[model samples]
Target: MEKTWWKESVVYQVYPRSFMDSNGDGIGDLKGILLKLDYLQELGVDVIWLSPVYKSPNDDNGYDISDYQSIMTEFGTMDDFNRLLSAVHERGMKIMMDLVVNHTSDEHPWFLASRSSVDDPKRDYYIWRPGKDGKEPNNWESVFKGSAWKYDEGTDEYYLHLFSQKQPDLNWENPQLREEIYSMMKWWLDKGVDGFRMDVINFLSKDQRYMDGNILDGKQHGDGSPYFLNGPRIHEFLQEVNQRVLSDYDVMTVGEMPGVSPDDAVLYTGEDRGELHMVFQFEHMDIGGGPEGKWNNEKWDLSDLKGILSKWQYRLEEVGWNSLYWNNHDQPRVVSRFGDDGEYRVESAKMLAACLHMLKGTPYIYQGEELGMTNIAFESIEEYRDIETMNSYEELVNTYGWPKEKMMAAIHARSRDNARTPMQWNDGRNAGFTTGTPWIGVNANYPEINAEKAYNDHQSIFHFYKKLIQLRKQHDIIVYGRFDLLCPDDEQIFAYTRTLGEEKVLVLCNFKGQEATLTIPTELHSLKATLLIGNYEQEESDTVSSEPLRPYECRVYLLK
Candidate 1:
């Protein structure tokens, strides 16, 4: 397998708004990130994948970009961003900015111009259509809630918005618009930004037929995913961007692609494809969602998760690359979702980290995940800040007449705000995040799970992640080894092996709280096994025993 800097490197994602607050503004800024550069460097991450810090109206929490070139005033000035970039590079680390080009804020200059009048020169910059049958342009639903089309009084034409009405979808079919985007990207690359994490990249190219999507049962609006996701012209647009801008830079690029299969991933990130280095697929992220979507509380099966992960590993082993992650800015805490977040939060967090870091892909660690931060259950709806969560509450309780408690329960389990809470730095007020009031309430358990506490503990999840990253840097087998699943049917034990020539490593993870015995494959019983790393204390070090794994026990064995 071919090797690259990005493939061998571990990325740490920093949601600036919640990471660290500077100037007592109750919001995380570039200076806040600068204050924690040493923290990130000590964590042994090679790249810092920053979420959108561009100028925005915060309609979608910075996903709705109003200006591509300017830094968000809340985040700080361009000079502050420059200083942060230099500091990161000086520490021998790369910083990747989030590229949210699938759509722009309604307040964006281009969108404003496009919506001003039907005859505006930039009118074609956005997707707009006349009302159909005295209603919306289509039956499509906004991802947050309500109709996807927002009617404009000035032009009397409805504009498409896949997300919130404030975030209008861009028309990728326009060559002029594409050029403007490419130029903006080049400008950033020229400014010494290492790379980009493209947001919802697959949603850029939509089916021009403007066809109606199939409506699910009891749903008012149709699912427009089929008409927009991974559209026909996606490859053309990606290749054009690559040829025009990306090809000239030696930077990492990972596209956030939802509704993408392994086959589509292969086409997007093939070695010779000249499109992207890798893509973040949402198949694993959607494990627990039910037919009613993310709001429902559905228990995910371990075997099903193993099947999905194994499929991606096997399929991408030869062609495209994979970006491994358990949770991000958009998902709930992994320890709470998939592991024991109560009695064994630390153990489960370490296990989850080991499981993901051992995979043959670039692993992304979301902010505060290293400290084993769990989800929060705010007592009142007024305490919540996410637009999606608020919309869901209104739609389910007010419109559908679902119990408020049921909706709140779903929010506790699945809300993106769970991940957006302020990072816990210490046990002090505001979790040492800010002196002033935080924009979103800090997790109440911050006193126990703060970074200061984790950094001081040797057996903490934070140190375990540092070791995992160091091992990735030390061993090539972990980066390029061919993966093979062991005991595929076992629901309790998640086990796999990575083999590179004569070197081999086996990883075992116990998903449940009970002890489970692992059946060692008889063919490799003779090989000497050295305990590389494990969450629990070790007694026997040089043998691969068929001993039952402890609750949330994860161990990596180096066999020779």
Candidate 2:
């Protein structure tokens, strides 16, 4: 495998709207981030993956971009961004901006011009089609809810929007539009920004057939993913992107591709392919989701998760690279979803961190994750601010006749707002995220699971992550080692090993609340082992024992 700065570095994702409030306006801003640079530096993260701070209408929490060049008013001005970027670089850390070019806000100047008339030159910049038989252009439904096509009275046509109606999909087929995107990318790179985390990048190229998707049981809209996801011309568009803009700068790129398989990933991230450095695949994230989609209370099996993760690790080992993450701004907290968030919140959080960080890829830590922040079960649906969550609740309860309590349970389990809650800095009011009201309600458990409590205590999850970050920096084997799965059928124990030349490191985690025995393999019983890190403290002699791991306990060992 080849080596690179991103491949060996750890990334920390910061959702600006919920990170910290600087002006007491109930919203987080860039100056709030500037104040926390020391905290990030102390956490030992190499890269800060800042979520979309571009100018927007907040329809999708900044995902719907109106201006690629200017900063969001809620996040501060251009000078604030420049200072934050320079301060990050001064601290020997890099920052990756969220690139949301797959779609633009309907209020964007380009979209405003595009919707003006049929013969408008900017009309080609967006995907527009005439209504079919007095209905929508196609039977596709938006990911949030309702028809994907929004009829515009001005143009006498409907426009495609994969997400909200306020977010119109861009036309990647137009050469002029592609040039405009490239020019915007150069504008940012010229400002000393590091790289980009492209949002839904694979959705850029559509099938162009505009065919109706298959509607599943009890669904109102068709599933149009097959027509738009990883389309035929995706590689061509990506190659053009790389050649025209990315190749000119030395920066890392990771595409947020939803339905990509391991084979498709190799094509996108392969060194010889000239597309991207890596991709955020959604196979593991889709585990608990059922045929009815993410609006259910289905339980995910452990063996299935192990299978999916191992497959990616093995498939991307030789050709492409992987971007390892358990949760992000769009997903719920990992401790609540995969591990015990009740009695073992701290233990499971550390275990989850170790499981991902020890893998053969770049690890990304979402903000508040280092403090073992769990999900919030808000009392009312009105308490949630996420557009996806709100739409899903209305559709499932009022439209589909789902029990209100059941849908709320699902919301508690899978809502993206679970991760968007304000960052808990201290046990004070509003979790110290703001002096005034927060945009969303803070998790009530912040009193026990805040950063201040974790930072002061030596045995907290925050320190455990700091040690994991430092270990990855010190050991070359952790970065380039080949992964080997052990005990694949185990229900409670998730174990694996990393081998590089003469060095071998073993990782073990108990995924459940009960104690599970982890037997040592006979092949390496005689080797001397030293404990690298473990959530629970035990004597050094116990490192080689077949003792039962207590309730989400995790341990890593370096064997000689």
lDDT of each: 0.93, 0.93
> Which 10 consecutive residues of model 1 have the lowest summed lDDT?
538-547
Task: Please give, for residues 212-257, the per-residue lDDT of candidate 2 as tens digits.
Answer: 9999888888999999999989999999999999999989899999
Clashes of each: 0, 0
lDDT of 2 at 514: 94
> Which whole-number lDDT from 0 to 100 does residue 337 have in model 1?
91
120 in model 2: Cα distance from truth in Å? Answer: 0.8
Model 1 error, position 397 (Å): 1.4
Encode model 1's per-residue lDDT on 8-100: one tens digit a residue.
999999999999989898999999999999999999999999999999999889999999999999999999999999999999999999999
